[model samples]
Target: MRTRATVAAVSGALALSALAVPAAQADDSAASYPDVAKVREATSVRAEGEPYALNVSFSNVKIAKAVKVGTTGRVSTAVTYTLTHGTDVNIKAADFVTDAFIYRGSDLRPDHRLFGDKPAKCTATSATTADCKGTIEVYPAAHELLNTDAGTWRAAAEATAFNGQDPAGETFDISKVGYKTQANRGTTLVQRASKLTVDASPEPVKKGKPITVTGKLSRANWDRGTYNGYVEQPVKLQFRKKDGDTYTTLKTVKTNATGNLKTTVTATEDGYFRFTFAGTTTTPAATPAGDYVDVR
Candidate 1:
C-alpha cells in the first residue's frame, strides 16, 4: 500500500509539470515579441489659385514581413496611393516621381524611390490614380541602421512633376502630399528639415535706401557632402501693391549654392508691397507668391 501511494504521488507531480511547461514557454515568447503596427498615407491638395486644402485619407494598407530582409520574425507595412486631376489639364503621370525617406535624428535618409509607369491623361472628364506605396520592415538590426536610441521613426512622401528627362533640370510642380508613421517612441518625429516659402517684411523702403527683403528657400535633407542636389537658376521676384494689382518687376536674382535669395528693393513711395518667388522649374501659378507687407 505504501509503495502504491508513493508511486501515485510521483505520477501526479509529473503530470502537473507537463501542463506548466507550455505556459512557461508562452510567457517567454510574449516577452521577446517586438511591437508592430500598420501605417497609412495622408494627402493634401491645392488648386492652382486657391488656398491649400487637404482631403487626406488612407487606402489598401497592408502589413507583412519583407522577404528581402531575410528575417522571418521581422515585419513591414505597405500603403498604396492614387492621384487624380481635379481640373482640365493635360498632365503626364510619368513626369512625376514619388520619394520615401527615413529620418534619423537631424539627418534624413532616402530609403526608396519609385518612378511613374506612364503618362496620365488629364482632361475635363479625365481622372487618374497612381500607386504610391512604401514599406518599412522591422528587423532585429533595424535599430542599428536607423541609429535612434528611442526607436522612433518618421516618414514623408513628396511628388515632383518634371518637364524634361533631366531629373534636376526643370520641375513644373512640387508638393508634399503625404506623411505618416507609427506612434513615435521618442520626443518628436523628425521635424521637417527643408522648407521653401516666400517672405516679404519690413517694407516701405525710402527710395534709394536699398530696401532689403530676404526670401528663404531652404532644405533639410540635402546631403551636405553631395551638395544636397543644389541647382542654380535666375529666380524672378515681382512686387505688387494689392491682391489684384499688376505686379511690378522688383529684380531677378540668381539662387546661390544653397538656394537662398536676398534682394534689396528701393521703395518709390509708401504703399502696400507683395512679393513673388519664381524658380526656374516653377509654373506661373504654382510658384511661391504671397503678400509681403503693408506700407504705412
Candidate 2:
C-alpha cells in the first residue's frame, strides 16, 4: 500500500489515493482526473473512519525506540505487530493491506507523518490473528523534516481491506469496506544525526609552547540535504596524556557562528586533543576520533 495505498495524512484532499484504486483504473483515473469530492471521500476512510467497520486491533506494535535520519539519504526501521480481527474478515485477501505509521503535532500536518515505502508483509497464525512486518521510511532530501521536527512522535495503525470495492469512486460506500484504525499506539523518537571533528596541528612542538586546537560541530540539515554548523553550542575541550587511558576536560568552549572551534593550550607532554558536544533534543551526540600532537 505504499505509492498508491500509503495514506498521506495531510489536508482533506488528494489522500484518497490510499484506497483500492487498481493499476488499470489508477492509470485511467490519472488521465481522466477524478472529481474533488471523490478524492475527499477516499481519504475519509482512515481520517474520520467508518462507524460500522470491521473489528481489528493492532497490538504489540514494536517499532525502534528512536529513528535517526541524516542528511542526503533515507532512514528506515523494521516494525512488527500482531493483528487480530474477526473470523469473518479475510486478511489473506489480495486487497487486504494494513500498516503502522508515525506522526507528530497535528494530524493534518503531512510533513509530520511518515510511512513505509512498501506494503507490509503478513502471515496468519490463526483464523483471527496474523503477524505483520513492515518498515517506516524517512527521506531527508525530501525536505519533509526540520531540526524542530525531531523528538517524540505518536504512532497509529490502520488496516484497509478493500474487499473488492472501489475506494475512489464518487459513490463509494465506506460502510461496505473492512477498515480499522487504532491511534496512539505509542511514541517514538525522530532525531537528527550529528558529527564532530578535531584537529590539533603543529605535530612536533616545543615544551611549554602555545599550541592551537581546532574543530567543528555539525548536524544534519534536512532542509538542505547536508550537514550544517551548529553555532553557539557549548563543546568540551579535552586532553589525554600519551600514556593515559582517559581524557580530562580542560575547558568548555562554545562554537563560533559557523560552528568552528579554536583554542590555545600550553604544550606540555605529548597527548591527544578532542572536542565533544552533549547534543540537544533534536540532534544526537557525536565524538570524533581524537587528534594527536607531539611535544618536544
Candidate 3:
C-alpha cells in the first residue's frame, strides 16, 4: 500500500515516526516503489487507540548481514526492547505480548511486509518494566514475496495486552481492541545468490591430447525455485597436478547468455580442473566439486 511521506520526529537516542497510509496501494514490485530511506537511530514510538499509556523502546538492533542474496542465505537479525507501563498500569510475565517483524516503505506505510510476525519473549525486569528479545528470519523466497528489489528495508515491533491474564477470556471486544506499535529504523539489504560448477571430460586420456573442460555459471532465482544463468560474468579456470596440492589458474573465461563455459587444455599429467567465481554485492560466491582427469 502507498503511504504519504509525512515525517514524525521521535525523541531520544531511539527514533520512531509514523508514515500516514493513504488510500492508494503501490505495486508489490520494488521496481514499482521508491526505496525507503534508512533510519540511523532508535526512535520512541507509541501505539494508537489504546486507552492505557504504554511506552515501547527498541535498542541493540543487530542485523545478521547488511545484504543477503539467496534462499540458501537468510536475512537474520535480533532486536531487544524494554516495555514500561504508566504508573496506573502494572505488567508481569505473560501479561503482555509483543511481536517483531520487518517492513519496507515508510514507518506507517509499508510497501512490503516480510518475515511473518513472530512472538517476542518478554521477562519482567520490575513491576512495570519488561525486557524482551526476538528475531526476524527472511529467506530468498521472501524477496520474491515482497517483490523486493536490491535495497535497504526497515524493522518494526508490535505489542498487545489483555485486560486480564487471558486474551481469549470474555471481557471486552477483542476485535475492537487495539495494540501498541513500536518501530526502529534500521536497514537490511537483500540480494541474489551466485553459483558455479565445472566438469572435465576424457578421464583417462592419452598424454599430450587436448582435454575439454565445461562448466556453467548461475544465480538463485527465487521466482522460479531454480538457478538461472548469470551471463557475461568472468570465471577462472584452474588446474592442480596430481603430485601438487596447489592449483594454478590456466585461463579466464566469461559466461555466454546461457551461462555456459567451455574451454580446452593440453593434457600433460593426471590432474584436476575447476572453475572459480568472484561474487558481487547482490550475490554470494559458490564453487562445485573439482572434476578429475586421469592421463596415461
Q: Provide the overall lDDT of each model, using Cα atoms, as 2-decimal numbers.
A: 0.32, 0.72, 0.57
**Better-scoring candidate (TM-score), 2 or 3:** 2
Q: Which stretches of candidate 2 lie over 4 Å from their true place?
A: 1-51, 107-111, 168-172
The sequence of per-residue lDDT tens digits that candidate 1 reaches over residues 19-103 is 1112212222211110000001111112232112222222332322111221123434453334333332123323333323233
| Model 1 regions lying over 4 Å from their true place | 1-194, 198-201, 220-231, 270-291, 294-296
Ranking by lDDT: 2, 3, 1
TM-score, cand. 1 vs. native = 0.30
lDDT of 2 by residue, 22-102 (tens): 332233332111232233245553445542566799988888877888976678888888999998788766556677778
Can you give the lDDT of residue 193 in candidate 3?
63
Weakest lDDT window of 10 consecutive positions for candidate 2? 28-37
- Worst-scoring 10-residue span by lDDT in model 3: 29-38
Query: Which is superior by lDDT, 1 or 2?
Result: 2
The candidate that achieves the highest lDDT relative to the unseen native structure: 2
> How well does candidate 2 score on lDDT at residue 72?
67
